[model samples]
Target: MARLPRLSVTDLPHLVLWQGHNRHAVFADDDDRQAFLALLTDAAAREGVELHAYALLDVSLWLLVTPRRVGALPRLMQGVGRTYVRRFNQRHGRTGTLWEGRYRATVLAPQELLAALVFLDHQPVRAGLASAPEDWAWSSHRHYAGAASLRALHAPAAWWGLGDTPFAREAAYRQRVHDGLPPEHERRLHEAAVKGWPLGDAQFLAALEAQTGRRARPARPGRPRKGGSKSVPKLS
Candidate 1:
């Protein structure tokens, strides 16, 4: 089957994810992580995308960003992927494809923005890398939870919705992480990222489809049987 086109639009928040081929450890040490982060930081600046939340795991990474231009995300991802892969290979003295495939991205509805951010933050905990999100050194959770201050990057405006003051926001966000997300919620976010579907409600999906004129969801799993119950029609 043909690949689905990515849903790209300006000023919309997107959750992006990409992992190492075969689930390999992409970061050997802190230096490797630093190199990858530098590439991402520079690419975001050059491509005009706003960096919001991010998490760097052993084999995968996630980013929350809003692009200022139509194709900024692609450009940013291309630049980061190329540069980081090259550096990683040279530093580690190994070769082959660095990534599993093209990164996956999903347009996030307004209400889902915070959920996505918190989800990204919780990756470390979920992976058993850290007991709490605030303990993770490679995530923007530090910035959100007041564990770190990143001068160059700014939090998404939607994050401010947590509270009026920084402390309030940080406290509230920590509480959110502490409270944790339901398994289904996390599953939806993960599945959407993997499938490159827009993460939103019916209205949000409809709006995306209307704006892009392309399907923003995955096709149904199976073909409808020709003859079902005669009295009850099959739902599409």
Candidate 2:
């Protein structure tokens, strides 16, 4: 079956995941990671995408972004992927596709923004690459924690709502990451991105459906009866 187009809406936060081909290491060293970030900074700027949070794992990378207009997300990803692949090939003395396939992405409601950010920050830790989020130098954790300044990074409105002062906000964000997300919530976020489903409640999904003219959530399991049922499958 043909795949559904990536669900992207302007001005909404999106969680994206891109993996290396066959689970190989995408970033061989700090230099490769730095190069990828530089390329990402350029592509995101050119495509008008606002970077919220990110984690660059050895075999995969996660990103939280908000596109300023329609088609901005894919354009940004495509531009970075193409250029990065060329440079990585030359640097590593290898060839062919660098990515597993197309990137996976899911649109998120405003309410889920902070949760998604936490999710991105904890990826390296969850993967056993680091003991703490802050130890992962390639992620946005340090930026949010005020340990580093990334020029391309943009804090979402929810982040601002964390506290009135910069230090307060940073402390609050650090605390949130320290608290960690529930396993179920993390699973939901991962599944949503992999399936390209919109992550939100009924009202939010309904509004998104109206805006996009497509199903915002998955259809119910089992066949429909003679009379239609009002129930929809809950996101697992």
Candidate 3:
């Protein structure tokens, strides 16, 4: 079956994921990780994509971002992916593709935004790479939890639901993570992200389809197979 083109809904936040080819370790060391983050920061700033929350794992990374205009998200991802792959290959003496293909992104609804933020932050913990979300320095958890003051990472407007003040918001976000996400929500988030489908209610999907003129959900009814939704649009 032919794959669907990626949805291009302007100004909506998306939960994005990309992994190493064959699940290999994409970040060989702390330096590699730092390099990729630097590239992301630059590309996001240049492309006007807001970096809300992120979790960088050994083989993959998760991000919560909102692009200011149509094409901003794709441009940011492409810039970072292409540059990072070049640097990674040179720095580590490797070759060929670093990523599996095009990264998968699922548009998020306003109601699900905070939960999505928590889910993004908890990825390290969920992967068993850290005892707690705060222990993962590569993620935005510290910034949101007030453990780190990283101005580069911004909290989404939906985060204001926690509180008006910075301390209140941070404390609330911290407690939410401390309580942990429900297993079902986590599983659903994982499925949506992996499948490149919008993670929202039926109405939200309908709204997205109206906006993008494309199906907001998976074209097929069943589970998305490995490599089922890969689409590498020309990066520029």
Stretches of candidate 2 exceeding 4 Å from the true structure: 225-236
* Range of the 10 consecutive residues with the lowest summed lDDT in candidate 2: 227-236
Put down candidate 2 lDDT per residue, 1-236, tens digits, no spaces: 57777888999999999999999999999999999999998888888999998999999999999999889999999999999999999999998999989999999999999999999999999889999999999999999888999878999899999999999999999999999999999999999998999999888999998899878877656775768775765543
TM-score of 2: 0.94
Residue-pair clashes per candidate, as listed? 0, 0, 0
lDDT of 1 by residue, 1-236 (tens): 88888876898898999899999988888898888888888888888898988899999999999899879999999888988888889988999888988899988887888888889989988889998888889999888888889865667776788899989998998899888889999999999888888888888888887899887767656555768543432222
RMSD of each candidate?
A: 3.1, 2.6, 7.0
TM-score each candidate.
0.92, 0.94, 0.90
lDDT of 3 by residue, 124-149 (tens): 88788998888888999888888888
Provide the lowest-lDDT 10-residue window in model 3: 227-236
Top candidate on lDDT is 2
Q: Which stretches of candidate 3 lie over 4 Å from their true place?
A: 218-236
TM-score ranking from best candidate downward: 2, 1, 3
- The global C-alpha lDDT for each of the candidates, from Candidate 1 onward, is 0.86, 0.92, 0.84
lDDT of 3 at 53: 86
Judge candidate 3 against the unseen true structure and give its global Cα lDDT, from 0 to 1.
Answer: 0.84
- Global Cα lDDT for candidate 2: 0.92
